[model samples]
Target: MKLAGLTIAYWCVLVMALVPMGCAWLAKAGQLGKPRRQGGFDNHNPRAWLARQTDWRARANAAQDNTFEALPFFIGAVVIAHQLGAVQMRVDVLAFLFVVLRLLYVMMYVADLATARSAVWALALLVNIAILFV
Candidate 1:
């Protein structure tokens, strides 16, 4: 049987959502970059830079919370779309948009760009709402 578009979209979302955690794991393992020492003269260590860019613990917590925040909307959209007999393409598109926006949101969050992140988040919310109505 052919897979539903929404199903595929959710799969993509699942994969994308794992990326940050993977990065975090690599960072923690010293695979990505080494941790920075304060007042150090060398500023070229990529791992150290990545580690110092943000609080990994806080980012992990925020990532988990972000996943929690979006999960319900993702589920609701899929269920409503399926129940309404909405076109598969449309449902998939909306779901894809949600995932993309959320991914962007995470990047923005990591970079500490609050305003841009919130805007992207709002767009994702709009997509979720549109899916519910569709």
Candidate 2:
């Protein structure tokens, strides 16, 4: 049942799992090297550091949190779809679309495009739902 030796849908899941970390990296970008006392990223208390961010940094962190929230549903949908004997190509394509929409959602969030981001988030949610029944 493996597509190219490692189902494309599963590979999409792995890539989706990494998206939140990428958002975290975006939140921490360019402040990783400065001294903590000078407003640099604080590894000792990362959540504190992240909480103190503003503007796009804050949005990126928010995106990270949102992405994490979405991950479970996406994973569960993909797993359930496979277990239900869904068509492999259809599942794979839907999963891939979900990932693309999610990545776009992150970018729109960071760019302060509230409307577009919300729209993309809704679309991704629909895509995830489709994966469940594919």
Candidate 3:
């Protein structure tokens, strides 16, 4: 189904594109806004500071990295679904499922639930594959 003649699947594509921005923001959040002189939130040496993150902040950073890693496949799957003229409803559902699974994955990562997070990550990968095939 389309609103304003735009397939629902494309909306998911838009969300997928915007997701990287959220990941980038979350990466910055891990820095906690300390001055560069104090060894935190350094512009010139950001990765080094982020490398020192611990607890949930550290997990959040990892989640951001994982999120970025997932994006290319997810976006490609959605685009391929559209190109193949897959059923819009199925494509949209799978795309939406991928997004939900990713959100859960991120939360599980931050909570340090390794088993659950990995499970959710696997599920999201499956969802992306389904979108591509369907």
Candidate 4:
């Protein structure tokens, strides 16, 4: 019953999913705010719409892509740690760190800081790897 609603690693997975949604929302909002949007929020072809962007909105789209790409590894690490009886407290802490670093990664991406964003991404990946080994 303790794992029903408050597992930290599970919450980390939920947050991981939500991160990309937030990026997409930022891109959509950014697109809608453009003074001369050639195409207004192309729900039917959003990737094409985003490809036409070249600023923060584009960065947001790219960040969303990176977030999605990172999910499988993070999810697998969490699941393996949980299944193999890794220390819950350690797993929870690493999961939380990964979430924090990933959020920072998104912020750095949207801010157009490529080097810092990569650093955050590396840190988040390290956290996931650590969760697996430690």
TM-score of each: 0.66, 0.96, 0.86, 0.90
Ten-residue stretch with the least lDDT total in model 2? 1-10
Model 2 misses residue 52 by how many Å?
Answer: 0.8
Q: Give me the runs in candidate 4 sitting further than 4 Å from their true place.
A: 1-4, 30-38
Q: For candidate 3, write residues 38-85 as lDDT tens digits.
A: 655777876787788688767887888888888889888888888987
Backbone clash pairs for candidate 4 read none
Q: What's model 1's lDDT at 41?
A: 23
Backbone clash count for every predicted candidate, in the order shown: 2, 0, 0, 0
lDDT of candidate 1 over 14-133, digit per residue (tens): 765575565455334443343345423234654444445446544644654676667776776777787888877787788777777887877777666889988998898898898787
lDDT score for residue 57 of model 2: 99
Best by lDDT: 2
Worst 10 residues of 4 by lDDT: 30-39
What are the per-model C-alpha RMSD values against the true structure?
6.6, 1.2, 2.0, 2.3
lDDT of 4 by residue, 1-134 (tens): 13676688888899998999999999889456544446667776777878897788889989999999999999999899989988989999899899999999999999999898888888898899999987
What lDDT does model 1 reach? 0.66
